[model samples]
Target: MSKDRPAPGDRIKPKKSALVQFTATTLQLEAFVVAFAAVALYGLRDSLYEKGPLELSDPNVIWVVGGVLVVALLVLSRLTAKPVGLAGGTVAQVLVIATGLALPMMYLVAAVFVAMWVAALRLGTRVDRERREYDAAHPETAPNV
Candidate 1:
């Protein structure tokens, strides 16, 4: 059986949620950075004791902690499609910033990501709101489908 393709304008447009999209993007990027931080910590493993400020007794500590945080971030990325995920994402952001305590340099990284998260929440919400209003005004393209 042959199927016909819809005209370009007749094709269904998916309803994209700005908040979820932005939150996922932010979490995914943060996950990548956290993964890199794990690798950097592995490189610094030998020097940690000499530096002596951190009490990490095992070299694998970074891998374990960073891995968990990365997983949490990735999960949060999916969860953002829901309302509860917004709060969860905020909590995750705090945890990411807290990494600054163990790695002082993470303060810079944390600040940048924190700013991005805040911007995502603010801007994404605004965009979503505007999109809803537009859809409401023009109902032809606003069906749940």
Candidate 2:
């Protein structure tokens, strides 16, 4: 079969809700971070409390978990670099938050909460930056432009 292509003005468009998509993706990122923090905190709390303060030689579980999370976050950030991803990410963030709260922990709950906040803020900033860049590149398709 022969292939067809769009003319110069026939720019392909996205159909999904950029905001919703972004929000969902962001939620996923947040969830992953929260879960990671839970594990990390649970693993490190003893050291933090027993010793004077945190040290490099501590459990290091957080580093391991955080490293994995960083990869996932980076991938999501790249994939959902568009407005749609931001919307989806937000939704995902909510789900993550809810799940995080439901889980059990001795004192890890507090650390998880803090991590969630940091993840949300950081992810929001990244999404915002991506949206700006996307808007600049595709002025016509940019949301609320």
Candidate 3:
């Protein structure tokens, strides 16, 4: 085995990643926002844009797509605790912005959420690094997990 590899008898403890927790929380909140946006979209469909964006003349489409997004977001939030979950979060950002195609004003809303997502990723990573350093510096304070 290579020098960095641990022997078969060695066991490494696993700790929860702060980044994953932060990201998952962000996603859960975003799902809530999207759900409300869908309701507002249904109400304003006739008053704004004439429901012609992408030939979507039926308001029911709004409910269907919105419901799908809400469910997808919640599921993504649960998955975000896993290693591959970040990729789903990235794809979710794209999907959120794409909703702008159906409603022009949503572009602005999507931009705000996108900004939040970026912040979570960056800030969470920083917090995780700092947490690791703190634990390393003061092992006595570390949890006995």
Candidate 4:
């Protein structure tokens, strides 16, 4: 046997799966919802730019700004380990709602995303609770492995 290996009588413990690790926290799920919302906003760029009521020198400005917001939210998602990330998400949601100033249609989109974000936070919390309970019940089993 390899020197690093445990003795014959030692118990082998399973490791958590990658998916479980990735979604282990409520922040992660909230970040995911925010990121999804960002992408959805980006997808509407062309339409918003062309038909949006905002009178800008160039319609492309909308696309550029929206794209930046999307990228920022995506980055925030990965930074949810810190409290600031959640704050950033809240700010992002406000910005999304503010998009209505440029494109009235965005009000509806933003509302939908906000609903989704709230749902993610609530559901993620429940899932996390369940995971903790499961781990408590099965001390020897790797959580969500």
Clashes of 2: 30
Q: Which segments of model 1 are wrong by more than 4 Å?
A: 1-11, 48-53
Between candidates 1 and 3, the lDDT winner: 1
Across residues 3-119, which tens digit of lDDT does each residue of candidate 3 receive? 665555555464678788888888888888788878777777667455425545467897899899999999999998676688899899899888777666778988988888898
lDDT preference between candidates 3 and 4, better one:
3
Model 1 RMSD, rounded to 1 decimal: 4.6
TM agreement with the true structure for every prediction: 0.84, 0.31, 0.80, 0.61
Model 2 TM-score, 2 decimals: 0.31
lDDT of 1 by residue, 4-123 (tens): 534335655666888899999999999999999777767776673333255554767888999999999999999998887889889998998887666667778989999999999999
Worst 10 residues of 3 by lDDT: 48-57
Predicted candidate 2 versus true structure: per-residue lDDT over 1-145, tens digit per residue = 2235344555655445344354445445554556575565556555533422333244465455445545544455555656555454444444443333323342354445446545655665677678778878976555441
Question: Candidate 3: how many backbone clashes?
Answer: 0
Q: Per-residue lDDT for 39-95 in model 4, tens only?
A: 554565555345456543453664577567767767766664465765776677788
After superposing all C-alphas onto the true structure, candidate 3 shows an RMSD in angstroms of 8.0
Model 1 TM-score, all chains together: 0.84
State which candidate, 2 or 4, has the greater lDDT.
4
Model 3 CA lDDT for position 139: 65
Measured by lDDT, the strongest candidate is 1
**Better candidate by TM-score, 1 or 2:** 1
